[model samples]
Target: MAGTKTIDADVAIVGCGVAGLYCALNLPHALRVVLLAKTTVDECDSMLAQGGICVLHDPDDYESFFEDTLRAGHYENRLESVDMMIRASRPIIDDLIKRGVRFARTATGELDYTREGAHSRPRIVYHEDITGEEITTHLLACVRELPNATVFENTCMTDILEGFDADGRRVCRGIVAEDAGGAHLQVNADATVLATGGVGGLYKHSTNYPCLTGDGCRVAAEHGVLLEHMDFVQIHPTTLWTQKPGRSFLISESARGEGAILLNDAHERFCDELQPRDVVSGNILREMRREGAEHVWLSFERVPREELEHHFTHICEQCREEGYDIFSEPIPVVPAQHYFMGGIHVNSDSETTLPHLFAAGETCCNGVHGRNRLASNSLLEGLVFAQRAADKIMRDRFAADTAAQLAVAASERSRFVAGSRDVTDVALLCGAE
Candidate 1:
């Protein structure tokens, strides 16, 4: 891996999802960072998130938010992780706004917050139905302007090269990557962060992007990194059921938050609309099994017609295009594989078991979300931990020593490739084996 096409950086971040983007934004400008993505930055799972970031904007809102999250996770959540996430919420939101991310606002010019199931108040800040798209676009712009940051799109990392360097101490030298053109390249760095999203694609039915095949977890596992709680996968309730089995389209939870109702084949509400996502999804599954029906229904009659027309124009139009009048009838739906509750294990500072390695977002299980995640909390987690990881790295001066090692590795690689005549295509260099 070290002798492949040589490149050097102080820090190398994998996957350009919300976590990687925010980490790049928070790192010191002097630190040379390289961000790798299998596709364009916007193609990651974060861009597909329709809900907004969750936060307790008012003091009175904390208890409900905390309880709802705990209930959703079946009380398996780590208290410290939950507290840190709650505390970091304000700063992350503030920073996002400061970085020019536009969120929906009320007519009075106040941040418009919406309430999802299991939430006691309106605490979700979004941009219509495309919250993730807005945030990613803004963060990507900020990253582009950073002098020390470089983004490699269409580059897929195959493995983390970890071993004793020339100095004979354990270290991560770099990664072997295959570019779009199938050319192999070595990206050497001092420290590496895996911000790859979830493993939803591992299941037959998933709402995640096609490329999210747990590549990060597999890479880490190959290096003997211990992963925790891999069995807890969260299936989202209310995905649009199509004739095409297992390719269910995501019907955003925001639809239910805005007053959509879930119905059974008998046209009766099957579960409490205000229950946590896991409960709702589980209940829907149970009902389907009992009735021997292929799918359930979600109706939007409770939402004001005008509000639906204004706030959910896209969904309404899509429903209409699907030959369903959402306002008048129930739309067929079923749960689909959505978020992964388990990932690379990390601590409060988002540090992985490996030294100088940090992870965040859907790729790392920081224990903030134990068995399940409350709707919209995923984005806030990414933003909060990204800053935390950046602060820890800067405080420890980890970049200085790591950057030097990376330079040396790059030099050695250049020397090795100087006389080599067999040039391999980049795309075939590395991939899921």
Candidate 2:
């Protein structure tokens, strides 16, 4: 048995992925922040997102992007949340760039945009095929440099510590966690944020980190926190197929967006490669069932070899290591559990029903992605809502601090008046004497 440990912070952020890191980053340096990671800080599913993050690009791109998202989500998305995410997209991307994210650029040095499935236009920005890694790593680096932030790796959040606030409202006191050495950890904080990624680890095969088993949602559920769309999981249309599986390697949807196509056993195109993920995945599954095939093929023959070498270096190297030469042959692909659209229910401000508790990323359902997620929207949504959660926390904390200061000032004023009266009365007594 190991000893118990307790720590305190102004804010405790669970999961050190993009959401957690960004949340911590957006917080002021005066506030103490504690970040917990299930494994290494870089092990979250956000690091595996190969496609670029979506952006609104320009003013004219708004309506089309909005409509495309609605259509992809089957109108199950909350309009306000969708609008918030889309409207915030440009600023979020700018923030990433300011944080030293090296997105792909054109010859003229302007940001290069690419199209993805379900997008009405080319609105996604990338750093080759590993955009997630690029963005997440940079954000992680920034968080690491913060003087008020502390990071705990190899720590798993077993559950959230619950209690009642001064007002008798249910609130979270932070989390009860277990570290790599089996030590019990109790992190008490004024605010607790759950950014524990997604639930793909529970699946037999998925394009998510095996550690991401919905810890936030599970803990929130156990504590009676409001959750939305618990069943709204999104299946990615394409991952590199393999029999010896651990984590599924996602074949970037941008591949299809660029020029790649899906072919059946008879080497005939079956599904429109540019449709929404659910539609494309369903078509691929139907094709496989019709032919009794284990997996279909993703062919990049139409994509120039130079483009492949430059844009998909990571994927190409991975395929080559797996004994498949993508340059000369089509690599096998299948659909796998990808993103979760439903999670801990949150309002537009990213506040959960429970006081002082919040969730972001794939762990929270803000209803932006609706029933099915459009390609490349996951990163944007995570970043957008994570900052919103941080902003809300800051706002509440500031208000509380201001009220406390005002109360103290009022008490001081009353005491001063009483003391002055006492002094005046003593002087009057002396005069009477």
Candidate 3:
């Protein structure tokens, strides 16, 4: 028991963020699933996302949303991936609502949609400013209620488990993991998913959880999984600037979407606040350079006091704690490493080149973001593709692959015990929600 333990599951998913949770939720109840987390689920970069999740609120708006996404990515986006995400947007939003997720509603009781940078119109649904929290928390709860799933916080993948099928091809078996007590584990499964999030922790300053060190891509590269756009890191244009260390606090892009503006040290508005993220971040850097200032300003003067209080409760509290009253004055802001648009390459169905292996969320680049990611699209892209990955698993994992499947079982039969951890219940969130 002290050495490497063996875990047998129908599917093993790494990373317990939205992608991981949603993937678990979508899988069939008959399948035993194991979800591994680097830390408690709340620390995921998905929880730090403050802006919102994009959707196709209007049928005619499809063209607008598509064009906006393309323009933001500088037309480097794969047309098929972008089209699939946009087409799948509303259904994903609807699915979240049915899963006990709470979204902000207007006076008429209709779901409220807001605008963000690079968005042509207000089509992003949110829950105040903690949209990611609301969405992922409920999804985590849904995942927790599944009797077939076990979530292991403090467990993380050190590397993927690999074995050859009857065809003599290298296939992903599952992941080699470490538990909270530092015991190695071989989690063998019929299908394996890498939902291990982003590369933000690699930078000295980022808005992501410190654990997101791009482990998924690193291991995927080790297995020679096709990767794309490894250099396409995204930096958000606005984060509350402080000399203090720790994760950078993001000032939601919706702040600008709701009419907040970025200002120079001289109190002059320098760039259009609602431009694509990369464009605005570049602008802020140039302005800071010209003025020899450490940081620029973000003025919420145009935003109503009531709106600030209601829409950005967390932001207001954090700024006040930092000695800035955002309701009356501007907050010092700077660009910081935020999202990774590049990742392990996948297709429209979230399938990587490797057999029985898949990737979703920030760890996998499906070319929807191209060279740059538009605001609030990360959550949508993650959910849409993750669900598709699950669907692909459900549809194809057990179909016409018996020779390879039997080969995988035979290869690992000495160590793997089917459903070895299936009846063992693992806690989720640990009351952090």
User: How many residue pairs clash in each candidate at the backbone level?
Assistant: 7, 0, 0
Full-model lDDT, candidate 1: 0.83
Per-residue accuracy of model 1 over 59-140 as CA lDDT, tens digit each: 7777778887888888999888888888778778888899888888899999999888877777999887788888998998
User: Regarding TM-score, does 2 or 3 come out ahead?
Assistant: 2
The residue pairs in collision within model 2 are: none
TM-score between candidate 2 and the true structure: 0.96
For residue 386, model 3's alpha carbon misses the true position, in angstroms, by: 0.5
Best by TM-score: 2
Distance from true position, residue 393, model 3, in Å?
A: 0.8
| CA RMSD, predictions in order | 11.2, 3.6, 10.5
TM, every model:
0.89, 0.96, 0.92
Which 10 residues in a row give candidate 1 its minimum summed lDDT?
424-433
Give the clash count for model 3. Answer: 0
- Model 1 clash pairs? 182-425, 182-426, 182-427, 183-425, 183-426, 183-427, 184-426
Query: Considering TM-score, which of the candidate structures 1 and 3 is the better prediction for this target?
Result: 3
